[model samples]
Every structure is written in structure tokens, then in C-alpha cells.
Target: MWPNPTIPLRIKLSGTPREIGLEHGRQLACQIRKQIEIYNTMFKETSKLDWPTVRDIANEYRVTIERLTPDIYAEIAGIANGAELDILDIVALNCRSEIALGLFSDGCSSLGWKFKDRTLLAQNWDWTASIKDNLVIMSISQQDKPAIHMVTEAGIIGKIGFNSSSVGTCLNAIRARPTDPKKLPVHVALRVCLNSTSAALAIAQLEALGSLASAQHILIADSEGPVGLELSPMGDVYLKPNDHGMICHTNHFIQNRFVDEPPWLSGSPIRLDRMRRLASALVADGETVTREALRKKIFSDTFNAPQSICCQEDPLRPLPTRSSTLFCIVMRFAPSTRPTAQIVWGKPGSGEGDVIIMP
Candidate 1:
């Protein structure tokens, strides 16, 4: 039997109408319930969810209900929050491995007139394994209105996808600097991205968020062939050329402006080193030039010991002492292909599932 199977669900919503009314709220709540049922069924798990049940889950997670306005949005947000709890419960039941690390990411667009317009993409990998797989869902309406975008995988709700509005995003552990718990969790940032519809809008959101957690590097890619390299604390942003046909980002900042600290301090030195080695190997093998070659290189673990691409609970250090977990994720955007290409490390059943397509 599979050690543990986590379900991943990704959705894309567009052309949704935004209006506030009791009927609208009821419809939104029904949609949220459907999403929850889909997530639970996907993982063969059970979830105790209702409008009120979901609301309580959101409250327990400390998620803000203000953004989930329009009554329907609020109900949907509550369901999304409850989905997160279902994922946690599943992990507690089936996770046989010690110290399973989970990761979450979000990319948001068009929030509050562009004050915080940047998409928020984050990695939440530490003590618990993030939702079964990297799952992201989003909803976008006409400009100047609230939309509902909910993401859940293996019963966990958050953000994890790249679609027409925005690109899927992930983070590489570059620095192991201590962070404050009071600040917003990285998962919240991923949710922010799921809420966005464009790269420009996502960037604006990041800028408006200001500084919450410690300094870290964010890698964002949009369906429009835009790849962004941004830094927190300093709030520096850089853009890469998508004209080259394809773009691939691992853990580490490509920009010189971003400093590279010791992995001991960054908690990803070895993983970063491994990613560098993989990149170098790919270049040596002449795979760096092609998108397929790059994907092959990312999955290669020639070193054997201390598997370069595998996720580690404690990478040469304890959790409390380490900055973040070392997990591997490769986001590839190839519009030339019939459908968008997305491959995540953990999905369901297979442990490593096939590439998921978003249309």
C-alpha cells in the first residue's frame, strides 16, 4: 500500500459576477460545499463540514473574514479554511513517516486598487506536510469586485496553481534567518497569489503586504510568460526574459542583488548546493537549453546519499534550529504545449503523480 496518499485539487475561475445578496451568499456557500466534497472524495477521506462548521474552522485558523465579503465569498472562505483542517486530520491518521514537511504557495492579483498588487507566492514547509499535494484554486471577477477562489488538496485548502490570470509560484530556502510567529504564515502568502489574476496585480499585492515574515526569495511565473524574482524585507523585484521559450526556478535567487547566506543559517545550503549541482549537470549534459532536459535534470539524484531533490525534515540541523524545510518543486510554463504543464513532488497514490494540466 502507498505510505500516505494526499489529494491535490486545482481550479481556475473567471468571468464570475460579484454582487452581495442572500441568494448570492447561498450560492457561494453551495459552491464551497461542492469544493469541499470534491477534495474529500479525491482523497477518500471524511470531512465534517457545513456552513457553520466551516466558519468555525476559519476562526480557529485565524484567517480574516473581511476579504471574504459578499456573504457568498465569506461562506466559501470558511469552507476553504475547513478543508485545511481536514488535510491536517488526514496527515495525523496516515503519515507514518516522522517529521513530514508540507509546503504551500499563492499568487494573487487585482486587490484593493493595486496598493498591494504583487502576487504572494510562499513555501510553508516545516514540521507538518503541507496539503497532500501542491494544490491551488482561484476565482476572478470583473475589476473592482470581490471574487471567490478556493484551493484544497488532500482536504487542505490554500493556493497552489498557475493559470491564465497568474502563474504558479514556489520558494527556495535561501536564508535560515529566524522568523517571528506573530507574523502571517507563509501559507497566507500563497493564498494571496491564488487571489490574483495577473502578474502586475500580483506584484502590487506583494508590495502592499509590506514585511510580515523574515527575509526570503520568491519565484513567480505567470501564464503570460512572465517570470518574477522578488525579495522580501528589502522588497526588491526583478524580471526574467520569457522569450527564451521556457523558464525554470529552483531554490535560490538568480538576481545578484539577492544575497546568498550560509545554508546553516539559511537552512537550505545543501539543497541550494544540490540544485546548483543539478543545474550544472544539466548544462554539462546539454539539457539546460531545452525544457524537457531541465525537467529531467531536476528529478536526477545522482549523488544518492542525502538525496538532493528529496524533502528533509532536519537538514543537518534540528527543526527549531533550522530556518525552513528543504523541499523540491519545479514549475514549468510552456504555452506551446496543448495545455499548461505543472509537476509537483507529492500528489496522491503514486507519491509522485503525473504532470497536471490547467486549461
Candidate 2:
């Protein structure tokens, strides 16, 4: 059973794309259905569009997804078959970011610091708590790509995670776009990044896919270092680390080119500053930022109340719109060794949390 309140369900997947997706669908059918329900409510409330309309929008991306990444589409088909849900429903979940258009209040804070021995990447995934139970940790093994270990919603193929090649990524949903449905969807882009052998290769793959579907930030890091890739349908910007080898991002775009929605989350700028300050302080004395340092100094801070780094639900908003830090993950990447992660199933430093370590 999942949503245990202490630990997230962990599942291992292997073999062909369809087989892995089938096992994922079969083992977590209940969670998958629940995710649909949650997203249905969220879509209606946030996008002002009912499930049927959302499905239609999701279907528009079908041809593009299948044409660009047939293997992923096959896996999606397997998931739909195994879950006994329409393929469109599963597709909608994967395309939620594009459909929502960054209208949702959900926001996340992500940072990466490269060290002499290893690089540290971390993030606090802030969103409505309604779907907490649907969260799962997946260890996926495929024939050609590096094995992936990620924490994603039940039906999404990609999200925040690292790979056997020591490559990892963090996502910040930006509220700006003239989305090109013909391009790669956000979550699918995440899967492509996770499948890469290095940060440089990941960027190359994302570039080859053409313009991203919507506005988003993907913090990609490997043993070589971290780069903040701010992607918009209009264009792309690469945010390199500071002189100290550190970078951080929140909901809003750091660069000025792309237009963004009125600071929808409001905390976007505040959290970004706090994150940089906290992360800079840790490494100011030339101290290597460790997972513990990130967990303590960066992700746990609640500086501006409901809008702080460790975000809290704003009761002023409607129940469907309220948001909070659902989970926190910190990962370490080093040369010639498998990357590792430490996940706090609940809000980090909230005292009521279970920390899980990945293999």
C-alpha cells in the first residue's frame, strides 16, 4: 500500500519499454487511477477546463510524441493497457504541465553545486498536497539508456531523478508560453535528459528535439558540472554556474527574454534569493556542500511564511489551489561511481519525515 505517511512506495522496473510500463501499470494501478482523479480536479480548478477538454488538448500532442519518441509512446501504451484507462488519460497526465500553462500555483526550488570530489543537486517539490499518496520512487533499467532512479508521479515517465551515468536533473515549471504541441512535452523531455550519458549530451538531445513544448527550467548536472537550461517555445537560455560553481532556480524565468505570467506563485523570486543565499553561505568558507548541508541550510528554511523556501499551504487560496512542499530530494554525483539520492518523504526539517536512500 502507498501513501503510508512515512515512506513512498519504491518499485523496480526492467526489460523492454512496454514490459517495464506494463509492470509499472499493473503494480500501481490503484495509484494511477487516483492520480487521474487528482489531476482531473486540478485541471478543472487551475485551467478552468474539464477533463474531456483537457484530454482533447493532450491528444493533440499524441502524433508528435509517438513520432519523436516511439519507445516512450509504446511504454505509454503499455501503461494504459495495464491500467485499463484510455491512452489519452495517461497522455494527459504526462502533458499536464503543457495543459496547465503554468496557471497552477505549484512551484519548486532547485539548486546545484559542483565540488572537487562530487556535485550536489537538490530540490523542494512544492505543489498541492492532494496527490502526495500518488508519489513513487522508480528504479528503471532499460536495454540502451542508463538505468534511471527518479521520484515521479505514478503515471509520468520522467521527473526529478538521476541516472547510472551520474547524470541528474531538477525541474522548475515556468509560467510563460506559446506552447508548441508539436515539440516534446515537458515530462517527456525529462525522460530524454535522464536517458543521456552526460549533461552535455542531455542538452544536445533536448536541442535535437527542437523547441520545448512550454516554458520550463531544467537544472542538469553530471560529474562535469551543473547548467540551468531555461527553455521556452520562443527560445532557450543556458544559465551557467557562478564563479563558485553553484546555480539555483525557482518558478519564474531568470532571464528577461521570455514573458512570464504575473508572479503567480509570488514566492518564486523570494525563494530563489533565499536559496542562493543559503547555498552560497554553505560554500562561502570553501566548505563542500553536502547532502546534510543542503537538507539543513537550503531546503528546510521557512523564511517568508507560506511563501518561503520550505513552502507552506496558503489557506487564503482555495483548497484545490493551496500549495506546499510535498517532498525534498538531495543527490550526490561523482566520477566513475553511481549517483546516490536522499529523499525526505515529507517536508524536509519538518521533524515529521522519513528519509529514504536510493541504491
Candidate 3:
């Protein structure tokens, strides 16, 4: 029998942070373990760090995380208990960005476009295909916080997601470093942003914590509009949409040139330019850009093969290092209705995948 292409596991949880997390842990235990093994090997191969060293680094952030965001910390503790894994292990998974310090060649393309009536945020999550099965879509509800629906690695709590408040976020990993243990880990920061009621509030929360632990580009959007926040330990820069009301970002820092962006993905520039041109073509003459238009014109483009906007694995590379577009998510946010995410399990334009909508 053939395996299903739409492989992401979906689950819903409500109540206290711990309860929500415990359900996440217990239900996705198999995928969580697989995620650990994948990350363990990836850490050693990409950053020359062993699992023990990674856990040690993750341990350093525990106190700071607990003090800064106790609710998320409690959730992490619950996930640990439910998964029957050490809290340090779960912490390491959540803090993978800080621990690795942008050492890996993870590439993604994100854009936020404002239509006349509604706004859209979309991205192609490109990374090693080894953990494809570890992805999950989580619908979480808490007492005071906005409800969240996000797609994340099984063991991670935060990632690309939108909340009940019409605020959505997309991430792009930058290959620049000097991570700070005192700050919130990248994933933790993502969760915090999803918990906020608005994009501005999310930015304020991250700024209050002194920015994220490492270098990253988080494209945050709400009913009003979108803002591209280039966060780093050195400083932070925000990129507003162009006059065309389009914001595009790949894996490099655009405004902050002081921070060195290694040549991890040489195709990044090519992909970025491609998106602008494609977007312009789609919206020329004030044409309204819709989700289907984006799906056909942008995310589906296979311009520079293997490294194009629609990334594909290079067979010449080893299985562990090869990367591809694991999933593509298109989110719609409007003032009058609830937020929703339309996700494709595989490459978007490939004509070979299934769509899953988030509630």
C-alpha cells in the first residue's frame, strides 16, 4: 500500500498550558522521538555539536525561559512529562535555533501581501526532508491568550502559525550568530508572538525581552498589515511593505547589513528577486492578488532547480543534508472573520499533494 502524501498529524487541545502540552506530548510521542533523532544527527553533522552538548546549552536557557514566559515553560514541562522525555531534551528541541546559532542551511521564502479587503501571509518551509513525518498541525486554546493554529515540528511548541486575533507569523532562518542565552529562544519567541493579540503587541513583547536569542526573520501580519522583523542579538530592524503593499523575505537580512549572512544559500538572492518579479506581474494594473493566484504564480515556480523558490532535494547531496520544500502554508486574515491557514503537505505547485485547512 502507498503511504499518504498528506502526512502531517492534526490535533486539538484546550485548558491550562500543561494540559495542552501533555496532550501534545502523549499523542505525538512517536513523531517527537523521531524529531529528536533527526535533530541529534543534524546537530552533529551541521554544527559539530553532540546531543549532550546541545542539551547542556539548552539547559542554560531554562531559567531564563521560565522567568520570562512561565506559561510556555509549563507547557514545555508538560510535553516532557507526557512524552516521557527529559525536560532538557524538549528544551533543546525548542531551542534548536539558539543552540545551533544559525549554523544550518535552512532556507524558506515568505511573503505578506495586503489585498483591498483582507491580508495574506504565505511561505514555503524548506528544510531537510528527514523530519517530514514529524510535522504537526496544532489547534490550541488557553484562557486569556488568543487561540493558535500552527504547523510545527512535533517536539516544538512554536512555529509558523496564526491565532484567533487575526495575527499570523512566518519564519526564515538567517545564517548569522552569537546566540544569547539570556533571551528567548527563536521558537519560544514565535509562540509568544502567536499568543499576542496584534502584530504590534507581539513586536513589543519580543523587544521587551531584548529580542530573540539568534538571528531570524519573522514576518508578522495582522488585519491592519504586515511587518517584517529582522531580529538579531546585535540589533533589530523592521521592514514595512513596499508601496505596492507587498513584503517579501528569504533567508538573509535586508536592512541590517552589519550582520554577516554566510553563503549558506546562494540561491536566496535569486529566489528573492524571482518573488518580486512574479508578484509584480501578478498584481500589475492593480490586479487583486488572491491565494490561488499566489499558488500558481509564485510558490509553484521552479526557477533555479533544487534551489529555486519551490525547493527540491539534490540527489548528489547526502540524504541528511539534502533539503526540499516540505510544506507550503497560505494564511488569510481579515477583520470581520476568523483567521484560517491553508497548508499543502508537499510542494505547492507540484500537483501532487493534499490540502489541510486549519480551524
Candidate 4:
């Protein structure tokens, strides 16, 4: 029922981890199974990872996730049970990058800007076009914390979203190597950030990752402010709005422990430079920035053809590894006005925007 104008699956679960996982598994059985199979073949061929090795790596991260947050593990277990799949399959789905290396490295182009009375965060999620069917907007309600709302792939527990607590997060995958399966993966960390009550708390959660694999930029913001933090196995970098009132990130590390690490995604530096120039031009013109302008900039495809921000399918990328811009999401968080988000179902350049209030 998900993938509707709003969310098809407006799920609300509050109970034990098993209970939550089971309900989630049952609710998304079809999509979950589909996602697992696609990832299985991709992982096997791309990373030379067998099912057993993938499982072993996932289980290792499972232990780390449980040690850090048992509730999430229980939820994952429930998903496995409900979906009628091995727990290791669910683990591998969450930790797909750990085993498959660069298989799923292409991610998003994102930023956060200070609006007059609220905070605005936006991004373009680049993923395998086949996974479009795996998209779902999940709303999770636990006992005491604020409910979490995320636009995620079926089996993945996190990607992008906000919470009733007013905290919001966005992510962009950085293609750095030497991933430490011992620490938290980006998906798990996103879930952890979703539960945070404030911006500071969300950042604290990231700071606590110790070391992480598959480096990524985690941009967080509440009504008060925004913080851009990059996490990797070696070290970390934290950034904020520039004098121009903007913080932007693409699929590369702005700063990191690995000084010489090359840009993971081919389009990363290109997009980063493009967005910076766009932001600078906006500031220099002294023009009033609106949501429309921001979206237009994100949807720009001036650079590298198929791999540009408003990406279209490429002829060179084989069918399985080929990806495109799945969606463009813009969120506004203000204490006074109910949080509102605008989403374009396909490439922002091609589709119209749909506005939804965070429930």
C-alpha cells in the first residue's frame, strides 16, 4: 500500500522488538523479498561475496548494533520472521555495503539552509532504478520517544526522515574504503539519529560511532540549527553553515581522517563544486532564496550526462548496477508551523512535487 501520494504504508508499531519486527516483516513481505534477491546477486558478483560470507559480516554488525541498541536488533529479527527469511538475510540487507564494498555506494546530493523562520533540508537519493519498488515511507512509534518517519527501502531501517521530536537527518554515501564492520553502519546510525530529541543529541549519537565503515556524510538539523558530520574508520569532520548561510554535501568526504582518500563516486567533486557555485551565486545576487530555486539547482544536469544530479539512466552502467535519481525531498522544520515536506516521486526535473505534513 506504500508509494502512494503520501505514504502507502502508514505503519504505527509500539511493542517489543520482536513484535515490531514481526509486524514490519509481515507488512512488507513482498517488497522485502524482492529487495533481498536483487541484493544477493549483486553482492555475489560485485564483491565476490557468497551468501555465507555476507551473512557472517552482517551478523558481526548485528552484534555491534545490538550492543549499541538492542531494540533495533529486535525489530530486525521481527522483520526477518515476518518476511519469512533468515535473520542473516535481514542483517545482510542492512549491512549490504559491508560485504559488497562499492556495490551500493552511489547515494545522494544534499544540503540544509537556514530559512527565515524554519530549517530547510533537501536531498536527491540516487539508487538502483530497480529498487524503486522497494521504496516505502515508514512511521514508527515506540513507547516514550517521538515517532520516527522515514522514506526508506523496504528492508532498510533508515535512510532519510524526521521525528516528532523535531530532529531530522539526511545522508550521502562517501566511497571511502577500509570499512570497519565493528562500528555502526550508516543505516543503523540513521535510525539512531531519528530517535534523537534534538540536534545536539543527534550529533552526539554520531560522535559516539567510534569508528565506521563505508564513510558517509550525516547532515542533521532540528528547528534551531544544522550540523554536517562525516564519519569514517580513521577520523571525522564536522561542518556548519558558511557565511553564505548554507551547508552542502555530495557523495564525498569534505574532510576526513584519510587525507588522500579519493572521491568515492565519480560525480562527487563535480556536484560539490557545482552546488557551491550555485550557492555562492544565490548569495551574491542578494536574491531571496525560495524552495523552488533550491529544487531547480538540485535538479540541474549540466555536468556528466547520466551521472549528473538530476540523473537519468546511463547506457554504460550494466542493467543491475545502473541507478538514477529516485526522489527529491525538501523538508521544513519550524516550531510554529507543522513540519511540511515536498517530494518529487521520480527525478525532480521530470515529476511534480507533492507536499506532505509530518504526522
Candidate 5:
């Protein structure tokens, strides 16, 4: 289960309050509660959640859901309303495999490479999913505000919609040297992206929102490509590509530029090495580029277990105390006809969805 279930939702406004409305604000709050309840019911079945209870939880966390501009909220709420199914439930099904594999990350970055045979490789890694049962599903749209749907053993807290103007929908974990609860939660960045429609807009939103905490790297991918944006609270931002046809990000920073700054303290390089090794093995096999092959590689227990993805202290030397997988996410964005297949393995042996197209 997640060490903490209380995720505070902090909304920062960039424009005037006149742009927002009361009805839209109430609707956004209602939708957030609905999505959270859907998650709690699906995963935390024993505990039934009511709208009031959900609001109470949000209030307890000091989450100001109303800070989002009304226009943005209306756009996002419209998408949530249009969804044929409960967005949270759909995400739960989409990530069933990772849930089964017990792979979770603080953040994740993936590259959707278009190869010669109309094939694509959706390579990704968990930054903090290793932390136990922290499962989060995030989405960002261009016109609407961004939202995050998070699920842990405790239950669900952040419930955002899917779709972004520029970056599409993405989620990542930002590694902080000294963990601080006061800083804006990483989910806020996700919300910003969800609210953005285009990459240019997303970038603008990031600049305006500013940083509440010191973050190491961000896991972002969309129809365009995947990017690992590393940042410091001081306003330094670095961009890296998932050039390896396949890229898996962990909590530790992986750029050579940042190597000189406390490599030992930032993140575990050894874990990165293991992921690289696995990627190499898969690429060598040639079949790793396929979505199915990538999934097999990601869920392989031969290299490690408990934490499906390894978290090592040192790549050169080995040490225990490493973290394991909490939830695994395999995102495949092929032609619309080719269903976006996601296999969630919440447990060992069997899983709950179809290999061809996630539930």
C-alpha cells in the first residue's frame, strides 16, 4: 500500500477568477469524487466511499480543488463526462499487469518509436513505483486542467482525466534530495500537463506554475515522443531523449550532465544498469521492439522479483536495501484500429485483462 494516502491537491491560478465559474467548479469537484469512488470500489472493495467522504478526505489533505480556473475545469469535466466508462476503472484495467507484477515508480518516461514495420516500442521504467503500492494514472489535455488518478493499497486520491493538447497524458516521479511534504506534490505537475493541449502550451504552463519542490527528472511521452525532463527547484531544467528505441527511467537521475552532482545521493545507478541490461537483452533479441516482447521483458522475474524493476544503490558494486516493483505499465499507441494493449499483472501467475486490448 502507499505509505501515505492523503495527497493534497493544490491549484494555482494563472488568470483571473472571472474566467472560472461556480457550477463548473462544483461539477469538477463532483467528477473528482466520482472517479475516486470508482477506484476505491474497484480496488478497496471493502470500504465504500460516498461523495461527502471523498470531499472530507480532500479537505483533510488541505486540497483546494477550486483553485483551478473554471474554463479549464469545464473542459476537463467535459472529457470525464464523455468517457464511456469510469476513467479510473479503465486505468485500473489498463495497468492491471503492473498491479499484478507489483511494479510502481515515483515517475515513468516512455518512448513510442515508429519502426520500419509500422511497429512501435513503448519502453518505460518506474522512478518510485518501487516504493510499495503507489499506482497513479494521470492525463493532461490542451484546453482542460490536468488531473491525476492515484491508487495504492490504501485507496485512491488524485483522479485526473486523460488527454493533453501537446504532450498527451503522462505521469512521472520527481526525485528530491530531501523529501519534503510542503512542496507541491508531483501530481500537480501532471495536472498542469493534463490541462495543456500542446507541447508549447505544456512548456508555458510548466514555466508559469513554477516548482514547489526540488525534482530530479520527469517522465513524459505523447504522440510526438518521450522526454526525460530533469529539473531542480532553483530553476535549472535539462531535457534528454529516450533515444534507445527503448528507455526506462528510475528514481535516480540518468544524465551524464548531472553525474558530477552527488551521483550516490540523487538516485541508484545500479538499478539503471539492470534496466539497461534488460533493454539490451531485449533489443539484441530483435523481438523486444514489439509490444508483447516488451511486456515479457518488463515482467521477467529472471533478473529480479518483488520489485519487478530493480533499484540498486550502485551499478559498479552491489548492495541490498534495493527496492522492487510495485506496479508495471506498458503503454502501446498504435493506429486506432490496433487497440492500445495494456496488460496489468496485479499478482503472480494470472492477470485480469486481455493481451490484445486492455479491459
Candidate 6:
């Protein structure tokens, strides 16, 4: 079932990045606090580090984030002020993967399908189920940039969303040789992608971040077409749409040359293959893939139980250690005047979500 009707806190704020962050923090203070607790607990259980040391380490990530982009830094600072938390704690939450030191990675499915003049960009972000109620969708209007509608976990600056510029990004985790402590974290890099107006620009930004942006598959799409990157702080790989005119990326690297590192997420290989077949069947060649049709495939659970595409918490694992499909999102940019993104909270096919319009 959907986590709860009260979930997916939606806020629309237009102003400077800092101002937007402050309003975001003030409105979602409860969730921000709860999410912080959850993240700290996960860090403790997974890594031997305590929350205090995590904060100190978060300072380095702060530098990375700041050096990467000043606007994002101000936004984080504003969130810290509005939420009444340390800037480093918020930074730590954003850099959770780096904090884990490459021990954990999440699963997701991102696909792009075209029909006529429309493009469908969709993803299912699978993570810890505990944050189902802590999820949020923030509509941000910043100076000199396109308005953004972001569907993400509390305190995450970016994830799956489309900008008013018709640019959309979907993220998937891939194992790298271990994160370089000096580079930008995945969450921070995602913010850079959302700020971009085109896939080529995002690729340039990712390249600029260098090896720090590594160990992930990032799919950047616009009304024209889409581009995929298997980024590593060491180097980056470029992925193009296959002959089927579709791109389906799971947690593992699909590019033969880039699949050297093993995946941190279990069942990644199976999920990738399953999603490809499903995408082929759901979106035929040269047919306009409607939002409804894509949504149905996104929420499919042919495997069901613990291993299904729409994952559920495994009874065999302890409560805090399990991960599930937290949310599913479909971002349609060309069907309407502005970008419209719909989400599926908690389990798939529940059909409960809010329509986010960025005008």
C-alpha cells in the first residue's frame, strides 16, 4: 500500500537558492529531522563510525559541494538555518554513499521512450523503505535557471525530476573502485545535472567534476534525445540509445567496457535484463509511449515477493537493514505546456500520487 496519504510533502517556492532552501527546511522540518535520524542510524549500523565523526567528515564533503557550486552551498546553508541543524549533518545526509565508503548502493530503473513529439522519462528509485513517509517533492524557482520539480528523499537536493527547460535526469547506482574522498558526492553531482539545460551540458559538468562523479550511471534527457554516462572519478563512459531507441539502466553498468566493478546492490543484473525486456514489450518502436502505459510497466512485479522489480522489505533481514522500492516516478515533458511528473508512493500500482506541474 502507499506509505500514507500524508506522505510526499509538496512545496512550491520561488526565490534565490538560499531562500528556497530556507523555505524548504522550514516547511519540512519534521521530515528533515526524522530523515537525519534514519541516516545516522544506518551509518552506525553499517559503518563503525559514530554520528559525531560523521559530521567532521561531512565538512570535507561540504568543501567539495561548495567548491563544486556556490549556489548549492548557499541552498544547503539555508536549509541548515531553517531546519535548525548543522550544515555538516545535512551535507552528510547528502553524502551518505561516500560516508558508507562504497559499502552500499541502491537500485533504480530509468528509461526513455519517444513517440511523435513527446518524450517519456521515468524511474523507480529503490531504497530503504523506512523513508517512505519522509519522501518529498519540491518545486523550486530560482534566478536565471529553469524551474525544477524534484521528487526525492528528505534532505536530498536532487534525484528524479525535470526542469522547466524540458531537461530531465534519472540516476542509477554503479559500483566504482571506491570513492575518492576529495571529490563531489553523487547527490551533489545530481544537483549539477538538474541545473543544466541540455544533456551535453550535463556531460560537460560531470566531466568537470572528474573522478569524484564516478561510479554511477546518469541518464540525461531532453525533448530532443537522451544520453547516458557511466561516470567515475577516474574516467567517464558515454552511452547512447540502443537500436530499439530506448535506454534502460539498472544498478549495474550495461556498457561492456565499463562493467569491471561488481555491483554493490544484489539482483542488479537480473533487474537490468528484466527491465529491458519489459521496456521492449511496453514501448514498441516508433509508437508514442503514453504516460499510463509506461506507468503500468514501471510498477510491474513479475517476480513478486522480495525479488520483484517493485521490491518489498525482506522478512529475512532486520528492519533497518532492508531496502525496498521507495517511490516510482514518471516525468512527461512534451505532453503538456509545462513539465508534469507523477509519483507512486511505497509499493507500485497503488495509483496514489500528486501531479507536479512546473510552469
lDDT of each: 0.36, 0.88, 0.89, 0.76, 0.38, 0.74
Query: Which 10-residue span in candidate 2 carries the lowest summed lDDT?
Result: 256-265
Who is ahead in TM-score, 2 or 6? 2
Give the higher-TM-score candidate: 2 or 4: 2
- Candidate 4 local lDDT, residue 178: 74
TM-score per candidate, chains pooled = 0.51, 0.97, 0.97, 0.92, 0.53, 0.91
lDDT of 2 by residue, 1-359 (tens): 44587778899999999998898889888999998888888888877899999999999887789999999999988888888888898899999999888777778899988878889899999888878888889999999989999999999999999999999999998888688899889899999999999999999988988958988899999988899999988789999999888999998888847655566767789888988887778767676567877888889999997988888998998898788999999999998777899999878999868788985
The global Cα lDDT (0 to 1) of model 5 is 0.38
Clashing residue pairs in all predictions, respectively, total 34, 0, 0, 5, 53, 6
Any runs in candidate 3 off by more than 4 Å, and if so which?
Answer: 1-3, 285-287
Ranking by lDDT: 3, 2, 4, 6, 5, 1
Cα misplacement distance, residue 201 of candidate 5 (Å)? 3.1
Best-to-worst order by TM-score is: 2, 3, 4, 6, 5, 1
lDDT of 1: 0.36
Candidate 2 segments exceeding 4 Å error: 285-288
| Span of 10 residues, lowest total lDDT, candidate 6 | 350-359
lDDT of 4 by residue, 1-359 (tens): 34654333456666766887898899888989898878877776678777777887888888887887788888888899999999888888887765666556565788888766888888888878778777876778777677888788887887798888778889887666778877887888888888889888877776775746667788888888688988777777888788765898887777676734565567778878877888778787887776677777555554675767776677786677777888777777887666666677677766544544445
RMSD of candidate 1 to the truth, in angstroms, is: 10.5
lDDT of 6 by residue, 1-359 (tens): 33365366677877998998898788877888988888777877778778898998888889878887889889989888889988987888888877776655466778876555767788778777777778877778889987888887777787778888778888887765656757878887777888888767877887776645347777878877677777766667777777766777877776635335764666777777787877777655544466666767655564644655777667886566677777777776664457677676655665455443333
Q: Which stretches of candidate 1 lie over 4 Å from their true place?
A: 1-77, 80-158, 173-185, 223-230, 233-267, 280-285, 288-292, 302-304, 312-339, 344-359
Task: Name model 5 segments beyond 4 Å from true.
Answer: 1-175, 178-184, 256-268, 301-326, 334-341, 345-359
Model 3 has an lDDT value of 0.89
Q: Write the per-residue lDDT of candidate 1 for residues 1-359, one digit (tens) a residue.
A: 22233324434333432222222223234343344443333222223333344334334224322332232234333343444333233222111111111111111110000001222222223222332323333333434433433333332223344444445655443342333332333445544554566556766776676532434444565545445444543345564643332233334444534343333323234444664555556545754233333345444342332323443333663322222222223334333432133343341122454543333
Ten residues in a row with the worst lDDT in model 1? 106-115
Model 6 misplaced stretches (Cα beyond 4 Å): 1-3, 211-214, 256-260, 283-288, 335-337, 351-359
Query: Candidate 4: misplaced stretches above 4 Å?
Result: 1-10, 209-211, 300-302, 352-358
